[model samples]
Target: MGSVVFSIDAELGWGFHDYSNPPTDRIESARPGWKTLLEIFETYNVPATWAVVGHLLLEDCNGIHADHPAVDGWFARERGAWRDRRDLRFGPDLVEAIAEADAGHEIGCHSFSHVLFDDPRTTRDIARAELETAIEVARTFDIEYESFVFPRNAVGHRELLAETGFSCYRGAADPPESRLRRPLEKLLATIDPQRVELVEPTVDKHGLVDVPPSLFCFRFEGMPRAVVETLAEDPIVRQAKHAIDRASRTDGVFHAWLHPNNLQAERDARRMESIIAYAAEKQATSDLRIETMADVAERAQ
Candidate 1:
C-alpha cells in the first residue's frame, strides 16, 4: 500500500496578509471553509494534518507575546496594521473547534505570526524565538504538534526545526531534472500533477522526514465562469486521480495540500469534494493508505 499524506495550512488571515487583497473579516471568511473541509474529511474518513498559526490558538495576542527584536522589524507594518483588528488576525474559536472535532486530524504548528522561515532577514535567534513561542503556545492549548508546515511553504531554519523537536515538515516539490521538461513541469505543476516520481517521502540532512507535496489543491474560482466550470468538470480532478494511481502503483507517497481559504468558495468546495471522494475510492479498492504528516514521522522513527 502507498501512503497519502494530506495537510492543510490553517491560518485565518495571517496566511494572506502579504497579499494585495487581504480579507476584510478573515475569521468570518474562513469559518465556512473550515466547516466544509472538516465535514469532507469526516465523510471520506480522511485524516489531515492542520498546521495552525500559533497566534490563532489564542483568542487574542493581548498578553503573552514574546518580542523578537531582530525579526520584529521584518513585518512591523503588516503586523501592526492588524493589531487592533483581532478578527482579522486571531481565531481561538476556530482552534477550539478543530481540537474538539478530533476526527483523526493532527494539529501542527504554522508559526506564531506566519513568519516566512526562508526570508534572509529571519536570523537563527529570530527563528528560534518564533519556534519556541509556537511550541509554548501549543503546549498551553494542549496541542501536540510533531509535524510542521513552513509559512507560505518557505522552508528555512530546518536544523532549528529538528533541534526544537519537530519530526517532519512539508518540503517543496521536486523539479524535473530534464532541461527540456523542467519548464513544462513548472507550468504544469501549478495546475496539474508533474512530480509523481519524486513524491516519495525522504529524510533530510538533520534526519527529519521530508514529506513533499504531490499537487497543490489549486484555486479555480478566480477564473472566468466558463473556465471555472470546465476545470470543475475534469482537468484538475483527473490529474489528482492520476497522481494517486502512480503513487499506489509505485508504492510512493502522494501528499496534497492547500490553505483553508482555498475552500471559501462553494465551487471550490465542491471541486475539493471530488478529489477527496476519489482518494477514498483508491483507499477502498487499491492499496492506498491515508495518513497525516505526524503518522509518517512516527513510522519513520
Candidate 2:
C-alpha cells in the first residue's frame, strides 16, 4: 500500500540548448531557492524523488560552448553564458549532491534534454532520443531508474516508454469537467481514464507503469496563497485525494509531482512552501506508502 508520491523534476529550460547536444545552464547550482527548499525539506524530514535531465547526469559539459550552446528546445541554439565560456563541464553536481545526502532518496529521469512532448507535435525523433539518452545516463549513474516524467508535463510516446525499459511514466493531469460540461459528464457516465489514469505498479504486458500526475494548480513566487487555497477547495483535489487514499487501501500506488524551477520564480517560494507544508502534513501513513515515481514502479514490479 502506498500513500502518496512526492517527486521533483529538477531540470533546465524548454529543451536542449544546442541542436546536437544538451543545455549548459547551471541548473544544479545552490541558488537561494535551492538552499531554501533543501533546508525546509530537511527540517521536515520529507523525502522526494529528484528526477534529473540526462544532461544533468554528466560530469562534463561536452556540448556547451561558443562553437555550440543550448539556446532553446532540444535542437535549438543560444549564445553561451559566462559559465559556458569555461570548458563545457558544468552540470549534474546538484544531482550528485542530493544522492549523497540521502540514500533512500531516488533519482528519476526527465529525459536527456527536457524534451517537450506537446504539440504542434514537436520532434518525435528527438523525444525518443532524449528518453533513451536519459535512460542511458541513469544507468551510467547506477540509479537503475524506471520512472519518467516529461518536461513541461507534456506526454505521449507510451509505446516508446515501454520499449525503453521504463516501468512507469508521469503524464498530464486531467482537467476536471467544467461547470458547463457537467451535463456532458453525467451523460457520458464515466471519467476519461486516459485523461487522468493511475495504474497499479504492476507492469503492463509490455512492462510499463502509467502514473498520471494530476496537478491541482501552481503559483508563482509573488502570487498570493489565496489562489492555492482556492484550488485545494476545488472538488478535484478532494476527488484526487480520495482516489489516492483508496489506492492506499487497495494496494495500489499514488504519485504527485513538482518542479524545482517553480520555486525559482518570484515570491513562488512562499506559495510552494505552503504546498510542501500541506503535502507533508497531509501525508498519510495508513496502509499508505510514500515513494518517488521510480520507487513506486520498482515496488509495483
Candidate 3:
C-alpha cells in the first residue's frame, strides 16, 4: 500500500516578516480558516504535520531577544511593527487546537523566527540558536518535534538539525531547468492538470528522512481563482486525486502541502476539503494509507 501525506506550513505572520510589504490582510484572513481546516480533517479522519514557527507558541514576548541573530531591522524588535500585533504573532491557541484535534496531527518545527537557513546571514551558530529556541518553545506545549520544515523551504545547516534531534525534514521539489517550464506547467494545469510527482522517502547522510512534497495545494498564479467556485470540478483537486491514485498503484508516496493562509478564499477551502475527501475514499477501498510526515519517517526507519 502507498501512503499519502499532508503537511501545513503553519507559520502565520512569521512567514511574511521578511516581506517588504507584508500582506496584512491575507495574514488576518488566515486565522478563521485554521479551525475550518481542523474540522475538515477531523471529518475525513486525515492527519497532517503542522510545521509551526517557534515564536507563535509563546504566550507573550517582551518584544526583543538579545540572544537572537542580528538581522537588520528585525521585525520582532520593531515596537511599532510588532508590539500591537500580538494577534498575528502569537498563536498558542491555534497550536493547542491542532494538538487537541482527534485526527492525530503532528506538530513540527519551522525555526524560531522564520529565518532563512540558506542565507549567508544564518551561520552555524545562528542555526543552532534557531533550533534550540524552537525545541525549547515546543516543550512548553509538552511536544517534542521529530519533523522539521525549513523556513521558506531554503534548506541549509542540516547537520545542525540532526544534532538537535530532528528525525526528518521536508525536501524541496526539483525545479525545471528552463524558466519557461513553470509558466508552461501553469498553463497546462489550467486546461488539464497532470498527476503530481510521487516520491519514495529516503534517509539522507544526516540520518534525517527526506519526505519530498509531490504538489503544493494552490491554484496557479495567473489562472482564475474563482474557477473552482463556478466549475463542477477544480483542476487542482483533480490533479491531487490523480496523484493519489497513481501513488496507490505504483506503491509511491503522494505528499501535498500548503500554508493555512492559502485557505482564506472560500473556493480554496472547498477545494482542499474535496482533496481530503477523495484521499479518505481511496484509503477505504484501495491500497492507499493516509499518513503524517512523522508516520512516514517511522516507517522508513
Best by TM-score: 3
- Where in model 3 is the C-alpha error above 4 Å? 76-78, 176-182, 189-192, 219-223, 227-232
Off by over 4 Å in 1: 18-28, 63-66, 70-80, 173-198, 219-221, 224-228
TM-score of each: 0.86, 0.66, 0.93
lDDT of candidate 3 at residue 129, scale 0 to 100: 90
User: Candidate 2, residues 1-301: lDDT per residue as tens digits?
Assistant: 5456667776544233433543333333223445566555665556777767776667655343232222334232323432453222234666666676642567778777665667454565656777767777677767777777777677767678777777787756554453356655532322222233344444555677666664432411123334544555423343445555565566655555656545554445554455445445556445655667766666667
What overall lDDT, based on C-alpha atoms, would model 3 receive against the true structure? 0.84
| Local distance difference test, each candidate | 0.75, 0.56, 0.84
What lDDT tens digits, residue by residue, belong to model 3 across residues 1-301? 7989999888778888777788876688667767788888999989999999998999987767778775766654335576788877899999999999988999999999888889998889889999999899999899999999998789999999899999999997545442356766656744464646788999999999999988888745334645553775677788888888887787799999988888767777888899999999999988899998999999998
**What TM-score would you give candidate 1 relative to the actual structure?**
0.86
Looking at candidate 2, what is the lDDT of residue 51? 69
How well does model 2 score by local distance difference test? 0.56
* Native-to-model Cα distance after best TM-score fit, residue 74 in candidate 1, in Å: 5.0
Candidate 3 TM-score, C-alpha based: 0.93
